[model samples]
Target chain A: MGILEVKDVGKRFGGLQALGDVNLSVKENTCHAIIGPNGAGKSTLLNCLVGKLIPDTGSVMFDGQSVLGRSPHEINQMGISRVFQTPEIFGDLTVMENMMIPLFAKRDGSYRLHAIKSVMNERQLREEAEQMLEEVNMLDKRHMHSASMSRGDKRRLEMAMCLIQRPKLLLLDEPTAGMARADTNNTIDLLKEIKEKRDITIAIIEHDMHVVFSLADRITVLAQGTPLVEDAPENIKGHPKVQEAYLGEAH
Target chain B: MFGLDKKDSTLLILVAVLTLLAPFILNPFPSDSGLAQFNAGYPDLMQRFVIFGIFAIGFNILFGLTGYLSFGHAAFLGVGSYSAVWMFKLLSMNILPAIILSVIISGLFALVIGFVSLRRSGIYFSILTLAFAQMSFALAYSVLTPITNGETGLQIALDDPRIFGGAVAADGSIPVTNLFGLEMRSAFDMAVGPWSFTFSAGYYVCAIVMLIAFYLAIRIFRSPFGMMLRAIKSNQTRMNYTGLNPKPYTLAAFVISGMYAGLAGGLMASMDPLAGAERMQWTASGEVVLMTILGGAGTLIGPVLGAGAIKYMENIFSKINDNVLHGWFAFLPDGMEDAVVWILHPFVGKGWHLTLGIIFMLVVIFLPGGLVEGGQRIARAFKGKKAKETSEKATTEPAE
Candidate 1:
């Protein structure tokens, strides 16, 4: 069985049938990409998987456990982390402090009240956070306020925050949505490096064909809330159905 | 020393010293001098300063840390006062049981209110808390008369049974609130030359408690939990997705601050054994909010400074009638003096709130970070001037 299994999932928001009978399976230790045009229910599907929304029908199982009816924090505690469309790092906190939060969550469950113990004296956690920052090449900027950082740096910091948890499954909803060419290439290389070094399963939803072709082991093209095609990246490149749905009928 | 770093420890020590020496520091002007009217060392006013300091400190813990602006915290204070008065009547005249019972009861009240109010956030949460407090005020004034003593308020009666201490004093008046035969009204007067300082036992007790509260607040502000609260304030959505629950953390902060307010109320009743429903009015709640924002909401010492400043102004400004204003501006030309008094007339006497409102406006607009930021700006300007002078001297000396 795959690490994350979705079966016959369906969702509706009032009059709109956002998702209808969708099924997806992401294998362990592999990068799976979901590519679709605008308004194809990519975000809705991601929300369903992350417990931000409950599917009207069917189930989402992570590591053979049902992930439905749980909170976002609970799903995160179960070793699933998500990178949002926009970076969601704590803007008011320093980068080092931002990194410490996910580490604290991983080490001490979701809700532990360590009120009396000073965060300053948590030498082990501080060192771990600093080491994570170093790995992201953000050690120098660790003391700077995160909100003042550039967009590329914020995304990098956010990725570090998620990865520090060592989540079993990482969900990326357009990790490099709006970026300069250099930053986009940097993110692609960083994801490649992460894939080479870690035993993680990444399920990314992307609109960028370059990002999809570079990192995806398996590609699924979705259109109008249903999967149009699912195949290996090389196989999906010349698929007629995908071209018709995503690229439009050019030529 | 109490899990505090060097800077924090020093701050705690400074605060302790200031509170311990308040009687001396606040009575700088001599009793016979013209400035004697400005002296804030009197027993009644001094006790109030410390008591309200405790109140503001507690309010800051919630509003400062979590960015949750509660508008009904006075209900907790009122609850605390009623509990303390009940303790005095039923248990004993000893202040210990009264204070303890007040804190516990107010904590429970906070739990119920916080649990319900925390379900909603922002203005809804504020409105919910306000509604709960107003409901409590109405009940205490009407339906809950037997327990709260209604409009007359809860006062120690002559026939009350004292379990630990005597029911009545030798003179047959109601026994004053005391700690092991040390009366809360007891005061010591010291005369040095023309200046006279009055130190009250009650003021010292309240001041020490305020110091402890302030120290505890400093620890909370620096703790991991405090970080979590700040994180919540920064972004609740990010916090939730980061695998941290924001509700329980905010509720805990709310309850802690409520207990602080309750402790202040208990101290107030201990100093003057009376519990009135008017203490729970929405305006009283607004006063603590003003104190926190005016002093510096998130800063450790800001709330206390704000509380002291407001209370001091309340006492001193309310005493200034047109006669006082006229006397101060008498040196000016006759027409100018009258003009000055006309401009200042609406800001003194019963118009002290108008002055407070204008000051609040100025602080909110110019010093968004409150009085703490204002002080920091002044210090930085001085330091900058000194640095410029030293740099110029070094450059000129090298040129010569």
Candidate 2:
């Protein structure tokens, strides 16, 4: 069985079918990319996997546990973290403080009632968060406000925020959507390094073909809320249906 | 980052020392000396300073952290005052039970309101709190009049049976509040040089409670719950997705803030031995909100400054009349004196609202972060123009 599996998922928003009959599996210790055109339900699918939106009919299993009915925090506790398409770092909190939030959740198991203590003084969590920030090349910026960072740095900080929990599966929604070309290349390299170093599964949704082609071990093309093709990147590049459904339209 | 800096500590110590030596400081420019007419350290006004300081601190919990603008916190205050008064009437004029009962009752009240109001966030939640507070006011005015004492308010009575303490004096007065049989109004008088200072036990009691409340607020401000509330304010959707429910955290904050309000209310009733329905009015609620906003809603010291500034203005503005105005312009030429009176004439009596209104507008417009932000700006300006270089470096650094 795959480490993360989506079995025949179907979702609707009122009369509009956001996703239909989607089946995908992410293997352990591999990067799987989901590439699609706009309105192809890529984001919607990511939402369902992270427990943001419940599928109308489907089963999502992470590490053999059904995540369909769990709250987002509960799913996070089950070791799956998602980086939003936008840089969703807590802007007002210092970069160090923002990272401490997830570390607190990770160490305390999602929800904690302890309202005392300097969170930064928690030796174990602080070390872990600092280590993660260092890994993301953000240690130098740890004292700065997250809001003050460039868009690329914000995304990088957000990524570190997710990784600190050491989730079994990390979901990325267009991680480089708004980044400059140089920043995008840097992010691709960072993801590649992280994938190579960690025994973690990754499922990413991306609009940029370059990022998908560069990092994905296997790529799935989603069109009109359904999977058009799922195969190795090189094979997907030449698929006739994928060409007609996405690239042809893009060109 | 919000840690108490040296300036803050110094200001606090100054305020404390000044409060401790108020009899001298307040009387320095007495009206009889042909100087300022305001004697701010008078017992009644000083009592207001500490009491309202407590109220604004509690208010900062909800408004500052979560950014939920409540318009009905005064209702909680009123409820607490009423409960404290009842404690004095039935139990003893001991403040401990009254304060405890007030806090618990206010917590329960806040729970019900928070449970319902938190279902809808932002402006809707604010309106819901307002509606509930208005309903509470209406009930206190009419439906619950027997218990709340209607417009006359709740007060200690000599005719009532005192279960714990003996009956009140023939003047229909209960004894002044006591702490373990020690009279709260008992005073110590000290004389130095040309000044005599009176320190009342009641002020000490209020001051100690205010300190504890302030400490608890500072704790809550730095707590994990505080971070969660700030997260909610920053981004609710992201918080939900991060696997924590916003409702429970917000509800807890609301309840805590409500208890603080209750404590403040109970303190007020304990000091005066009366609880009026007007305490729960919308305008009263609006005053704390104003105080919190005027000081700097999210900052720890902001609300206290806001409360102090507002209360100081209230003490000064309410006392200004045509005679006082004429006194200021007594040295002016006749036409100028008349012009000054004309200029200041309409802004007295109930017209005190106009002064407050203008101040509120100015604060909100020019100083969005309130007096706290203004202070930071001033400090930043005085530090010199070179700080912008450091700010550039600061922005590049990731704060995590």
In terms of lDDT, the best-performing candidate is 1
lDDT of 2 by residue, B1-400 (tens): 2444455456556656765565566656544444555656556666777788898998899989988888889989999999998888888878999999999999899999888888988899899999989899999999999999999988887765667776675465657788787677787766655444567777777877876677667667767778888887887766765666777888888998898899989989988889988999998999999999999999887887888788878887788888888888899999999998988887774478788889889999999999988999999887756677678678878773
Fraction of native Cα contacts kept in each candidate? 0.72, 0.49
lDDT of 1 by residue, A1-251 (tens): 89999999999999998888889999999999999889899999999999899999999999999999999999998999999999998999999889989988888887777778888998999998998888889999999999999999999999999999999999999999999999999999999999999999999999888999999999888888888888999989788888888877334
Docking class for candidate 1: high
Where does the lowest 10-residue lDDT sum fall in candidate 2 chain A? A112-121
Name the runs in model 1 displaced over 4 angstroms: A249-251, B332-336
Q: Which candidate should be chosen as best, given DockQ against the real structure?
A: 1
Looking at model 1, residue A8 earns an lDDT score of 92
Candidate 1 CA-lDDT value: 0.92
Error of 1 at A80 (Å): 0.6
Q: lDDT by residue for model 1 over B1-400, one digit each (tens)?
A: 9999999999899889998899999999989887888999899998999899999999998999899999999999999999999999989898989999999999999999999999999999999999999999999999999999899999999998778666788898889998877899999999999999898999998988888888888888888888999899898888888898898999999999999999999999999999999999999999999999999999988998899989999999899999988989889999999999999999999999999999999999999988988998999999999999999999999889
iRMS per model in Å: 0.9, 2.2
